[model samples]
Target chain A: MHELAPPLTLEQGLRWLDLIGILAFAMSGALLGVRKRFDLFGVVVLGCVTAVGGGAIRDTLTGQTPPLFLRDETYLWMALLGAGLGFALGEGLARFERTLSVFDTVGLALFAASGAVGAINFGLGPLGVVFAGMLSGVGGGIVRDLIANEVPEVMYRRDQLYATAAAAGALVVVLLHPHVTSFQAQLGGALTIVALRWLSRRGWVSLPVRRVPGARD
Target chain B: MHELAPPLTLEQGLRWLDLIGILAFAMSGALLGVRKRFDLFGVVVLGCVTAVGGGAIRDTLTGQTPPLFLRDETYLWMALLGAGLGFALGEGLARFERTLSVFDTVGLALFAASGAVGAINFGLGPLGVVFAGMLSGVGGGIVRDLIANEVPEVMYRRDQLYATAAAAGALVVVLLHPHVTSFQAQLGGALTIVALRWLSRRGWVSLPVRRVPGARD
Candidate 1:
């Protein structure tokens, strides 16, 4: 890896993808709030938390106190918009789980890339950055599962390529760092993750988790 | 500060108080679960979290990974017992908020002292230890309030004396660390917190927010 680097260019792309991804995540959170019959205020809070909870935690752990919600209201507004739309379209949205899944996947990809980017920006080494990226991308989902009183899907024996995609994307960023503008690398990383996850979903790709002969349990 | 001497009697007294205090705190956590209308499983989880969440977080920040819950089942069982009693005797205990508060104060005192001790054990000085103590005592309550969706009582400008009690107790321990066994100092600290918090609840102790003449608005 080169010791010096050029300027990062993924700013606009990252922001747009981040927004889309967060909005999708927020919609999912809103649906849960609706199912719980929470008040509108609760729905908004829950939606925003679902969108950003994990990243917020990762940032805090890295010493970004009080965190992004205190720094910007953009994400909150985006989540609010998504949740508001979701509340109005709750029944209609259920029929389009396929469409929602696509959006969720896009969000996952963008977040995975950006999570790594954010961690690297904070000067974390490769391992820490990769961990932070995965944490940021999947943390909200885990929190949602916990509150919903279900074990987090990512922790189950067969996950839907959620955390794995994030880790892969993060690894890509780590490898490409110092060799490319952060933007090109992030976009490439995001697309790679989405493609991999999409392929996994379509049964075109699968992990070889089964033990080989004589392997210890 | 005498750097070499120790107090044997104070150490023994402290040991007894710490044990009983832990039991009391764990019991209170179980009772909280019952009030939340939790099932047996929910009750146990809530109780254990209430008993240890703050301490665990504090330990994490202090660079102690994995935390005590990963190592011990004492809190879990205690919480289970508390929750069971609370669930079974819930209706009859509605009028016991006052009693709960008193018990909570005792737990708070112990928790505060323990937090201080833990921080000190982890190499923090007086200031950090005092802060840790205060956080440990009220951290679980804050988490409980967040989940319950109420404004945390500790954040309000009330004369609750919760954190204040913890800080006072921690200060006592810090000041007397050398002359007393770690146990004695901790006991003194816990008693100090309990006394202050209980007195405040009964309208006996209150702070006036000591202000300087030129203090900024």
Candidate 2:
């Protein structure tokens, strides 16, 4: 059994984490737009879309109205701030890619956990909850890549675990939900995903793949 | 002025049109999956997602729960049938691409009109309504291309008016909403989109494209 933080403190911590995730995702999207040489409007649009895409998808799936970002304009403002930073910094931000990756992982883990929780609250079944969780973690990145005309890294990057990590994390949340507080379950799930990603990066784990007969080289 | 059909007749007609659209979209998506050499499961998933994607997006945006397809299993059955046909026929279906395209256009127009009406019912502004409509028409196609790892044709196909036509059709719906019945407005909107698409295909209309400075070839 795990001890729970006070409700107010837990909520505040989650809010800050969410904001951090939003800012990181927005910057990542804006930087990609810059590299793609999209016009200024396109860059900002990509940033905002990436930041809010996952949450919006989760909310829409669960019948939440108007989406959380629309309800809370602060999220949009943060996305704009991150996008502006990315556009202004341009190539200067490239050097910090490693640091950004860490934040990206953080965002992914939290999103997967929160999405699973939301689906559970909405009475989704196990498979639905797991799928929702994975979608929430990676949907923004997928949208960013789509807009930039690139294959989504999560779909094709089989060398290291990404979506698999998210799925595992969501499964963790689902398994723990019945036995623990929601906050505890969420934290445990996030930690599990982060750990899985770290392990996969070091070649400690990997998913299997099979080449199809007669497929192109 | 226009003569209005009885409500029951209009509803049934709309239902049939919806099913036709779903079938065309599912076949198109499945055909693409086949061309890409995806597994049977992947092909079926692509087909179903393409068939249901637009209306799901529209319903979610308008705060509708479970979406229409989830509520009505007939749509899923139609999508499955279309996918099965595409898979069984394989490359042979390519010869009928022109016929499929016609049905695709019909689907696009009707979806755009219905999306605009949905947005209007949800009390969205004109811009939001128009956006909703265009997304409804093209959203499925975009998703299909994204999963297939290609640039969305609608985004780069400037030689023809696709999304623009949907937006214009939606504008028509918005403009006529206060002056006519919903059904009539939707019919007018869909017809306008179909006409625009047909005209554009004949080289009579096109959107402009500009090359950015220092961009890659």
The RMSD of every model to the true structure, in order and in angstroms, is: 13.1, 8.3
What are the per-residue Cα lDDT tens digits for candidate 1 across A1-217?
A: 7687666655665677678888899888777755654445345445766887776778678876435543455766687688787666655667777877888888888877877887899999999988988888888888766555457777753435768888899889888878998887787778888988887887766655766898775
Candidate 1 lDDT, tens digit per residue, B1-217? 7596666675566545544555455556566666777777776666566667777766665656566656666555655565566666656756776776676777788878888887777666665577568778877766665565444455433456676778789889888787988888887898888788768778887643322234343
Off by over 4 Å in 2: A1-48, A61-63, A68-142, A146-217, B1-8, B213-217
TM-scores, chain A, per candidate: 0.84, 0.93
TM-score (0 to 1) of chain B for each candidate: 0.78, 0.93
RMSD of 1: 13.1
How accurate locally is residue A67 in candidate 1, as Cα lDDT from 0 to 100?
A: 50
Please, what are the lDDT tens digits per residue for candidate 2 over residues B1-217?
8999767788799979988999999999999999999989899989988898888877777677678889999999999999888888888889999999999999999999999998888777676677679878988887888788776666556567777788899999999999999999999999999999999999998753334446674
Q: What is the lDDT of residue B121 in candidate 2?
A: 85
DockQ for every model, please.
0.03, 0.14
